[model samples]
Structures are given as C-alpha cells and as structure tokens.
Target: MQPGADDPWSAPVATGPVRATVTVPGSKSGTNRALVLAAAADGVSRLRGALRSRDTVLMAAALRELGATVTEESGPGADQGDAEIVVTGPVGAARGTATIDCGNAGTVARFTPALATLARGDVRFDGDPRMRDRPLTPLLRALRELGAHIDGDRMPFTVRGTGAVPGGAVTVDASDSSQLVSGLLLAAARFERGATVTHAGHRLPSGPYLDMTVADLRAAGVVVDVDDPTADLLRAGATPAASTRRWRVEPGGPRPLDRVIEPDLNSAAAFVAAAAVTGGEVTITGWPAATEQPGRMLPDLLVAMGCRAELVPDGLRVTGGGRITGIDVDLSDFGEAAPVLTGLAVLADSPSRLRGIAHLRLQETDRLAALAGELGRLGARVTVTDDGLAITPVPLHGARLDPHADHRLAMTYAVVGLAVPGVTVDDIATTGKTVPDFARMWATMLAG
Candidate 1:
C-alpha cells in the first residue's frame, strides 16, 4: 500500500556509489494526451504501457464522464499497475450532463475541459483546493472565443456545450502554462471550422510540450501547420518576444491509435541523478532515441554538470564524478525538471543560476518559494530569482522537508537526502501523483 499524505518518510542515504538499472512507468503527459486524442478519435484506440497514477487515473475518469469508454486490463508480462488501456471513442454529441474532478492534475484540469466543450449538455469541472489557483483563464477564454459557452472564469466552472463548436481563430497568452496551448490544440480538429491559435504572450515556456501536442495530433492524422516567429526574428537579428507562434488544425476525424507509451523520462531523471550525487552509475532502461518529452535533454544537462552520460543500446547510462561543477542555464522548455536539478546544483562547486521559470510560481504549489524555503532549511543558500533560482553551495545538514503538497518538491528533497543524512520528507507519497511507487523505486535503486 502507498503511504498516506500525513506520513513522514525518512529518506535513505547512500552508503556507497549507487550502481543500478531503473525502469520507470509510462509518461503521464503522453498517457493523458493519448486519452484525450483517443476520446476524439474515429474508433477504438489502444494504449499499451499506460501509467496508472493519480493524474492518469483522474484523466481516464474524466474522459469516461464525457461519454467515452476507458477500460484497463493487465498486459502480459507487465509490471504492477502496468495495463493496456482500451479507449472506445469518437464520443458522440448525445453526451449529457457530466462532472469532472480534476484532482489537481494540470493535464486533467486543462485538457479535459476542452473535450467537454464537444459534449451536448452542461459539463461541470472542479478539482482539489489547490487547483483553483492554477491558470485556467487563458484556456477558458480561448474556448469562449472559439464559440464555447463557459459559465465561470476558473475551476468549478461549467461548460455549457451546445453539441457543436464553431472553432476559428483565437489568440491566447499561454506564458503561464503550456497545457493551455496543448489543451486547445488537442480538441481543435473536431471543431466545425477547425481552429487556429496565436500566442501573444511575452514568453512561452515549455515550447517542447507544444511540439509534443502537435506531434500527437499529427500521429492521429490531424493536419497542423505551426508558424514560429523565432526564425523570422532571428533572420532579422531581432530577439523573439512571442509575437505569434501560431498553429492551425484542420477539422477532421483523428485516426484511432495503436501505440505503446514511452517511459516517463522526467520521473526517471531522479534515478540517474542518484548516480550523479553518489558518484556511482545508473542506467535508465527503454530510453528513447528521440522523444518530444522535454526530459530528453537530461543527458546534456547532466553532462553540463560534470557528469558523463552515454546512450547505450538498452538505455541511457550516467556516471557521476566525485565533484560537481555548476553552470548557468535556462530551463524554459523543461521547468518541471527544475526542482530536481536545483537539488543537484546545491552540491555543485560554484554558483548556479537557473532562469526562465517564473511560471513555476503557479504550478502544483508556488514551486519557487517552496524550493527556496525547503532548500534553505537544509542549510543551502537558495535565492528565489525573478525567472528562476540562484543557488550557492554551502555545507548542508539533513532536515525534515515540507513539499507543500508538491510531488516535485518531495522527490527533489529525497535526492538531496541521498547525500545529506537524517533527511526526512513530509508526504513522500505525494510522488504518487506521477510515480505510483516512488519509495520502492528509490530503495531498489540504492540497494543495487
């Protein structure tokens, strides 16, 4: 059984170099995206190796509420919780009243609502108390602009679907979260006139996730034309400021998918990071040669921090030197990895500046403030920067870390604990939001 939220877990410290091979579950982002696309597809879509976690489970449930059938059965030779998800789709216009509990999952809160607009009756969306603060206004307003009738400006809102949406052009400021953009694009192909989205924000973080959304849509046979303004701006020697990174999706039925979900590289990074911290080696099995997931940059990031990373036939292997060197970097495309990277940076030889992540302030928790407070509590000099963080290495000690209900924070502190003894994490089970059995996985990696 998983630990409860109130449970305090003593994070295990490494006795020697950690040498192990770790395999992670399916991608939360990919699974949820596949669920949405499957619900919109023409026929049955089968997803093998889908992750069973709070977020993905909530996503499947939300789709079911929208008149789609999502079933799960254990796959042959699959790990615990690994299942083949069968989604019978092209949810019709007869879908009646439905209520979606987003449960603080950003993908559910953002992506599910777009699918709700295609329903024929009232669809109410609500989530955990923390979900009320996440950015939904942009997506909601974009839906409204595309002929969707929404009752409120935020969560606990009602989507008064009229059985059809006259999707057309709409401009959105999605700097706060890329999910807003992905949510719109995912449901656009079903719109009567298709859909066109233009980003007018000052900055667009997590640009790679948008690529993932577009790629998934293409895999489903949706025609998407992306107009990136950066190339033109660079040709003119002008810095791009997000004038309009537009995407146009033509109205059509997405082809049913039969694909295997890839391993979640974001969550897998912690194990590879264990190697970096303990001066050991770790191999992450089933590492894809290419992926739209932003975590694909892990090898480059590790190499920048004085670690050696190689892609082997089976997976990606990382070997850490006894010493870690700091470097300056911008994590706009992969800010979700910031917390764990910050933990690694605390042990670096020089100061580290992580920039382009101000939007983290509005995620599961105010990540910037939480990381600053929690890391500072452990005797590290962490200053919350405007767009990211600045960390200076100092002698550290173990302390009970409060993740403030954020799973990333819990994992980040746990990584720090592998080096700093006596460290404890409040609500280590919060990692279940993504990694269903994080505690066991960490222990197994260390035991090897």
Candidate 2:
C-alpha cells in the first residue's frame, strides 16, 4: 500500500560505521524503457530482473491499458519485491478511448503519450496534479509535427490516433527535460518515415541519459544518427560535417527484452550515502563495471565529497572517513545523483555548490524549491540557484521535512536524519515510487 502524506518516519541517526552489502532491485529506467520497447516490438518479450515499484508499475499498467499484455512473475534475485514481467507487443486498439495514469513518473508522462500515437483511437492522459505541470509541450509539438492529432498541450490531454504517424524531421527545444527527446525516439521506429529529432536550444542536459536511450534503441536494431553539441564536443576535428543537436531513428520495429536488466544504481546510491554518513563501508553486489546509468557517477561524486571509493571484485565499495568535505561540481549529465550530494553537503565542513540541475524544477516536484525549504527547516543556509543550490555547512538540528510528494526529497531526508537527531520526514510512503521496501532496506543497511 502507498504511504499517506502525513505518516512521518523517525530517521535513525547512525552512530557507527554502516557496514553492509546490499543488493538493490532492478533499474526503474531499464524496466520502463523495456516495457515501452517491448510494446513496440513484434513478439513476446520477457523482462527479467525488473523493478515493480510505483513508477515502473505505472509504466507497465499504462502499457497494459493500451492493449499490451503484461504478466508478472516472481523475480529471480535476492530481493523479493522484484519481478520478471512478460510483455506482448503492440496489441492493437482499433477503437475506444483509453485513459492512462502517469502518476508522477517523468518517463510515463512523456513516453507513453507518444506511444499512444500508434493506436487507432483516442488516448487520454492525466496523473497526479503535479504530473499535469511537468513540461509536455515539446513532445506534443514534435508529435503534432509528425502527424499526430493531439488535443490539449499538457496533462488531461488526448492523442487522437489514426493508427499510424508520418514521422519526419521535427525540432524541439528540449532543454527542460531529456525525457521529451527520449520518449519520442523510443517510439519513432513505428512511424512511417521514422524520425529526425533536432534540439533547437542549448546543449542537452543529462547527456548520459540520452546516450542510454540511443544505446537501447540501437541495441534493439534501430538505426540512429548521433549529432549533438555534446557529441560534437566529444568528437572534435574529425566529423565537421556531422549535424549537431539532432538524432534520426530509422523506421522499424525494436527487439524483445532478451537479457536481464541491471540493478537500479540510482536507488542503490542512498545505501552508498548511508556509508558516507556513518564512515562505514558499503559494497553493493552485482555492480556493473561500466554503464550509462546516471548512478554510475556516484563514485566520483563520493570521492569529491571526501569518501574513499574502490572497485572490488564483488561490487563497488565505498568507505567514508571521519570528515566529509564540501564540493563544487556540475551535475548536468547526472542530475539524479544531486540529492545524495545535497544530503552530504548539509553535513560537510565547508560550502558546496551543485549546478546544472535547472531541469530538476520540472521533475516529480520543484526539487530546488523543495530542497531549499526543507533544508532551511533543518537549519542549513541554502541558496536556491537558477540551476542548482549553494549550501553552506552549518550545525543542523532535528526538524520536520516536507517531501512535497517527491521520492528523492523523502529519501534525502532519511540521509540527513542519519546524522541529525529528531528528524521526522513526512510523506515517507512517497519513497515507494522507486525503492521497494525503503524503510526495511534502510533498516537492514543500518543494522550492519
């Protein structure tokens, strides 16, 4: 069951080294992407090691509602809440109105509405009131340019489909959300002309996330052309003719989910932060040596914060010494890692600056505002920036932190509570959006 807004959890402040080996569940990113890709694929695709959290469940449920067949089975892993889901592809809905509930997941809000364009009937979308506010204009514009008859520009909108889209060149200023680009690219292969998506604004934030989408798309047999300001920045002097801020997906179908999905590294980051807070060692088993998941950047962020990180045979091991230092870093490529850093910054011995997270304001909540307010209530001097936060280290005391219906905010509250006394985090149940059994998992990590 989902936790209510008023249920506050007493945070357990750690008094010693938090030694534990935790195996987190599957990636919400991977699971949701797989669900969308499988629904576009030609045959039955089984997603092993999938997360069944509120976010991914919402994705699966939306796909199921749109005529795709999704079945869940017991997961083959250490975590019991995990599951193996089987999805049947592109079940056609020739007629009818389908309503999709996106909850607060960015993936669902942006991705599913485009996928609905493949249907023959009208697909209406709405979610939590906050979901209604997240940016959908770019995606809607791109869809309309591709021949989709969409009504209303945001949530509570409708996608009137004629069973096919004449996909072609469309430009979008997707500076506010990377999901806007990813959602379109994921389902572009189904379009008659495929798609050529060009970003008309500044360089894309969270480049790794876009890389993940392209990698997944190409792995599933879609042909994509990589031409972005950042990609050009990476490959200099060799490809002068390459187009910047553009991605072209060849019209075709994708493959099934034929392999096991990796664990949610971002979710595992909270446990890693626990080690940092208590000056203990945390070794997450089955850590992929390399990947595009944003959480893979945690080691560098931790090291910058004065924690010791090393790659061990079992997994990545992070050890926190007594003192935690503040840092100045740009988190544009990996914004998901910001909250963990924010939690540590409050306990640091110096000032910290986290920049390039302006996109966060469009997330599950206005993250910058939420951080500024909650951390202020906890007695920290926080300056909310245009893109990030400037936090000054100060002695913190216990206080109530309102999570504003955001999972990351609530999770960060728990981390702050690990060092400060008498911290109560409201809307504790919101953590269910990603981390399964968050309280129990946190307890187990602290028990060691």
Highest TM-score model number: 1
Q: What is the lDDT of candidate 2?
A: 0.86
Q: What would the per-residue lDDT of candidate 2 be over residues 1-448, giving only the tens digit for each residue? A: 4346777788888988899998888888888988899998888998888888888888988887778888988876635358989999884683378888898888999888778888778888899998888889889988999999999988889988677899999999888888899999999999999999988776567878888899889888889997767566666756333324889999988877576788888888888898888899999988999997988889989998889988899999999977789999999988888887899999999999999999898888888988988899989888999889999998899998888888888889899899999999888888888886788788888998
- For every candidate in turn, the CA RMSD to the true structure comes to 1.3, 2.4
Relative to the true structure, candidate 1 reaches a TM of 0.98
For model 2, the stretches where C-alpha displacement exceeds 4 angstroms are: 1-4, 77-80, 229-244
lDDT score, candidate 1, position 340: 89
- Estimate TM-scores for all models: 0.98, 0.96
Identify the candidate with maximal lDDT.
1
lDDT of candidate 1 over 264-366, digit per residue (tens) = 8998878888988999999999999999999998899999998999999979999998878886999998998899899999988899999999999999999
Q: What are the Cα lDDT values of the candidates?
A: 0.89, 0.86
lDDT of 2 at 301: 90
